[model samples]
Every structure is written in structure tokens, then in C-alpha cells.
Target: MMGNFHIVSNNPMVAEKYPDLTEFEKDSKVKDIFAEGRNSIHLGANLINHPLAGSIKPNQSPYKSLVMSNEKGELDMFSLKLIEGALQVLKKFPPRGIEYDEQTLEDFQVIDLDLLDSAIDSLPYEYHE
Candidate 1:
């Protein structure tokens, strides 16, 4: 099954501007965490902890993806069958690439739970199902 994951942007500036993201510092426990096989970049904590816990390979899908929170408010919001669940959030906050190396910063992203809570509230029931 496809696991729940975050739509990480290589750019920290995006996270800095948005309240949803809290930047990772270089000394953080997860400072070195990165999507394996993919170019190293900032990873959202919500993305790193939940679905990618046992991740062993880079996503092979041609399309980039994200996983929204489920009705129970868990990040376990998507699998292969529930891809449509993340579409709306993805549309509104599409991930972007950075112009510099990601290792330069620290805080990956501690999801603004409040923002995610609200976003999850607005998604259709189908998204949670």
C-alpha cells in the first residue's frame, strides 16, 4: 500500500512563509532525515514520522504525491486506493523545488497541527473514507 506522506518542498522559504511549517534546525534529531534515493531536501515532520517510517526506496510513481490527515485526525490518510483524498490539499499547496542545497538548514517541518486540522475539516468525506 502507498503510505501517508508529506508534499515536501526543497525550499525552506515556502515553509517559513506558511504557518503550517516550522523549519528544522541543523541540530535537530531529524536534521539528516531525507527522502532516500531522491535528492536531499527539507522533509515535513508530518511526512517523515508517519508514512515514511519504514521507507526503503524512493517513490517510483511518475506523479508526485501527498497524504492528508484522515477523519480520526491521524496522518494515516492515504493508500493507493485513497489517492483522491489528497488532491485538494495538493492543489492548494503544491510542493516546490529549492535553488540551493537542502543540507544548509535544520528544521525540516513540524506541521502546524492547527492548520492541518482546519484543512482536514474542509476536505470532503470521500477524502477521509
Candidate 2:
């Protein structure tokens, strides 16, 4: 059986904190976690943009949809460890915009919400029809 581990978050903190989980996977601890039967782990700024990535809101759902699997896929202890490791890295960094382009305002959205609205409104009026 083959499976994959993915970490997706709109939070730019991910990019800033742990730029690459693949690099961390090289660590003995990370390797041991995925020893079970996982294929790969990835980190991204937007989960919704990825083909395999989806968003899960705790209150909106019965369970946390943080992880996903193929029809026959599942996450094991190793997967949890991988998430933990990534989270630890995020905690260390603490989303302070330390790194250039790390979690920029654009990631969250422009400073002015109305600017976005104006841009959207400015789009070809014919499209509305």
C-alpha cells in the first residue's frame, strides 16, 4: 500500500517557518514516522488551490478534515508525527513576517478589503450578463 502526507494552509507562516518539509523528512525522526507506508509530504500556502488538498473547518464538521486519503488511504501515527513536526517549526517561527515575502499581506489579502471589491467590480461589466 502507498500513501501520501500533505500539509496545506492558507497561512503563509508555513512557507516562512518550514520552507520545506521534504528537507525535514530527511531527519531520522521524520523518517521513522513515515516508515509505516507513506510516500511523500508537502507544504503549501493554499490548500484549496491544490488538486488533492481541501479545507476542513472544525466547527463546520464533526471531525477535523486536516488529512485526506485515497479511497483506500489512511493516516497513521507517522502522519501525525509529520504534522507535529511541521507545527513545531511553525511555532518556532511565530509568523512575524521575518522572512521576505513570508506570509505577506497579499497572502492574507490586500490591506484594504474594498480595493479587492473595486477590482472585482471593475471587471468587464459584460461578464455579469
Candidate 3:
């Protein structure tokens, strides 16, 4: 990942792995994270990773992580549009009503973390910090 970007995540594993580079939102749901990303985009941060990256649907996983530009600049229409689309997709899926067990929750966290790692790994190494 580039040094100019930062992560916004509701997954504890992500927060633990990249403490300084993450804006951790404890106990936040997937939609909440997307909303936060949308808010950041409105404030001029561009989305670095797609909000709906993994195979896990919004209702399948409780955790979410997104990367965004750290520097605030002029509004990015692409980022705004992407985040809005994500929010709309989120609304299509009903909530995961059933409460997950501890192990299941941990599994969800691992999946989210893995997806985040993939995004970070895909970035060019030249600007990594």
C-alpha cells in the first residue's frame, strides 16, 4: 500500500495489524464502515480499495475494511460514485439476523483481514511506507 493512504476498518485484526495506518471503528458494522468511507470521500479522500471486494456479501460478514487516501484534496467523483454504489448494494441485503458464536465471529474477522491484506499486497511497493 502507498504511504499516502490509510485504512478504515471495523475489524479488530486489521486495527491490530496496521494500528498507525488505520482508522479503527470498534464494534461498527459493514454498512457503518461504508458510510464512514463515503464520508471520507466527501471530505476529499479517494477510495483505494473497493468496498465490496471479497466474496463475502454484506450479510455474510460482520466485519469490513477499506483503504482511502490520507490527504484531503478536491472531491473525487469516482470515489463518491463507488461508495454510493456500495451503500445501495448494502441496502439490498438484509442484516445477518442470527447472532454469531465467538469462533464464527473470529472467522469473519480473519476473512476480512485476508481481503485487506490482498488489497495492500496488490499495491506497488515503491510508495509503501
Best by TM-score: 3
In model 2, what is the error at residue 79, expressed in angstroms?
0.8
Which candidate comes out best when scored by lDDT? 3
How would you encode candidate 1's per-residue C-alpha lDDT over 3-120 as one tens digit per residue? 2223333333333543253332323212122332122211212332232312211221111222332223323322321333233323454334444244333322223233333454
Residue-wise lDDT of candidate 3 within 9-101, one digit each (tens)?
989999999988899999787889999999999999889888895578888888899999877899999999999999998999887688999
Superposed Cα deviation of residue 76, candidate 3 (Å): 1.2
User: Clashes in candidate 3: how many?
Assistant: 0
Candidate 2: list runs displaced more than 4 Å: 1-67, 72-75, 98-129
TM-score attained by model 2: 0.25
lDDT of each: 0.29, 0.29, 0.87
Residue 98, model 2, lDDT: 38
Better of 2 and 3 by TM-score: 3
Any residue pairs clashing in model 3, and if so which? Answer: none
Which residue runs of candidate 3 sit more than 4 Å off their true CA positions? 125-127
Error of 1 at 42 (Å): 16
Clash pairs, candidate 1, are 23-107, 24-106, 24-107, 24-108, 25-106, 25-107, 26-106
Off by over 4 Å in 1: 1-111
